[model samples]
Target: MTYTTEIIINKPRKEIIKTFEDSSLFPHWQRGLKRSRVISGKAGEEGSKRRLYINIEGQSIKMTETIIKKNLPEEWHGQYTSKGMKSIQKNYFEALDDHKTKWTSQSEFEFSGFMKLISKLLPDMFKKRSVMVQQDFKTFIEEGKPVKTN
Candidate 1:
């Protein structure tokens, strides 16, 4: 499945991108994230891989993240793989003005094994999760703090 979601952040694109690139700040906006570490390559560089542990609804989920593209303040792309799901995320940022930015994301997900069944049964869940994460990031950038707990 594929979809796009967007939000307007009341901050400059540079500021938003700064926060987005900081791995230390991820746990704040990514509500379920438990821990993350770079397993190979230099952090933030294309081809770098990061392992993430997320506690989703009391279940521990693990995923490997690879940076696909890193054109900051303009675009970023990444791929994420978990047990039965794979996702590619393309993110774009546009400066609306001196103090406002527009964030857009195009996400595609493919399910296999057991997740295929879950995907068919609750397709909206993926979309909802994507939007929720975007909103959380918006709140974090605008308010200068994480609104959701990890």
Candidate 2:
């Protein structure tokens, strides 16, 4: 499955990129994200790997993310792998004006085992989740709202 999601952030591209590059700020916008730790190479750089722990509903999920490309304020790409699914995410950033920035996320997912069935049955779920994450980031950047988790 492949889909694209986008949002316009009410901030300069440079400001948005600065915040986006800071791994420490991820949990504030990324819902259900518990923690992340670098596993190999340099964090955020090409070839770096990080393990992410997240909670969805009541289930704990873990995924490994490897940076594929990092061209800040323009584009970045990453590969994420979990138990039964893998995704390639390409992100593009554009400056719409002096105060507005556009963030576009293109994602392609490959599924195996049960995840394949789930993907077929609910393909829209993935795109919806991606949009929600983008909106969460916009809220965090514009209004200082962090995703609330229990």
Give the per-residue Cα lDDT of candidate 1 at 9. Answer: 90
Per-residue alpha-carbon lDDT of candidate 2 for residues 1-150, written as tens digits (9 for 90 to 100): 898899999999999998898999999998989999999999889999999999976879899999999998799999999999999999999999999999999999999999999999988888988999999999999988888831
Error of 1 at 91 (Å): 0.3
Worst 10-residue lDDT window, candidate 1: 141-150
Candidate 1's C-alpha runs over 4 A off are none
Q: Tens digit of lDDT per residue, candidate 1, span 1-150?
A: 999999999998988998999999998899899899999999999999999999887889999999999998799999999999999999999999999998999999999999999999999998898898999998887776685632
Residue range with the least summed lDDT across 10 consecutive positions in model 2: 141-150
- Assess candidate 1 and give its lDDT: 0.92
- What TM-score against the true fold does each predicted structure earn? 0.96, 0.97
Q: What's the TM for model 2?
A: 0.97
